[model samples]
Target: MTDLQQNYAHVYNNSVGFGRYPCLILIDFAQAYFDPDCPLYAEVDSALASALRLRKTAQTANIPIVLTKMTYDVAGVTGGRFFEKAKPLEAFLPGRATGEFAKGLVPQPTEIVVEKQYPSAFFGTSLASTLICLGCDSVLLTGLTTSGCVRASCVDAMSHGFRTIVVADACGDRHDAPHQANLFDMKAKYADVVSEAAALEHLATLVTRG
Candidate 1:
């Protein structure tokens, strides 16, 4: 197998096991979608700022950064079912600015942007393969709708054998209760949930030795 294929296999086989490498995964931070007025909006203003800082820190550390956005066809071909069910107050029509990543948290040219149609970033997506290609064994997750997209991504990351860490304060939900609930469950079962401060402190340790 090619080295890339081997890495992919390793990730699949060891799902949840830590690898020597690490990457950062930022879930759905699109401007229109993340609005406070949206149905899924979570008042995570503090978290958003923290996420931006983390993105910068990761960039400085030369870590691979991957960002995701929920995009639909201009005619809403995809996620139409979603629109009917959830009726997102804000939807990501294709080729629109609303679906774009938040300007404040824009991805650098070197960063990867993965457009997804579902909750889990890995679902029908190449996120796993991309992580493997980047030699990423662990994923530091930050993003919006803590109880939804952020939580889903974390779970899948863990299941894919990646050491998943969710920056608690770097993720937001529309309300306090659901956010707290998801975080608690994630910590107990799926992933390690830590505050943004804590994640940054831990990352500092990694950087100091390098």
Candidate 2:
């Protein structure tokens, strides 16, 4: 297994670095993932902390920010097949407190809030268009469940012609194995999995230029 991973890196060793315009996309940092009583509780407080730090940097740099939350119609019809496949999604049903952003991660009024019913934020939403309209050439993605919505959004962001940068420290999952594996996979193919310090340094450049 180790040998194959090394071989794949040689095969897919290409990097799409940060672009001139970047938007920080915070995906599904919902209270459900932080609440102990919820099935989706990830117990990844540190990842949430890293995301908050990045959010502050993005704001200071005047970068566009987009926050996404999973939501479904009261009857769950909006979630479609994904909802049926993942029963834990009930936590995101309308008016449920678990659907709200986690304590330290609230969207400012000027930031965009995209309510998505599917795993990929761009699947049935205006995310791609919104980013394009904002003149964004890159996506700085962070959020819960690195192997799930974060991975999905990374791929979709790339497909939509944006360079996707996944902040490694800012993405959490139910367990470390999936989180690490998914981060490896994304860095190899879809997105650039980068550290919080690296992301902050990049944002610092933007601030200096302005």
lDDT of 1 by residue, 60-167 (tens): 777888899897766665765655666562457766566777768767899998988878888769999989887888998888788888888888988898888888
lDDT of 2 by residue, 1-210 (tens): 678677896687689999998999888999999899999998789988998999898999998999998988998999888899999999999899999999988679889999999988898999999889889999999988899999999999999999999999999999999999999899999989899999999999999997
**True-vs-predicted CA distance for residue 29, candidate 2, Å:** 0.4
lDDT of 2 at 46: 91
lDDT of residue 201 for candidate 2: 97
lDDT measured at residue 97 in model 2 versus the true structure, 0 to 100:
97
lDDT of 1: 0.76
lDDT of each: 0.76, 0.92
> Candidate 1: where is the Cα deviation over 4 Å?
1-19, 33-41
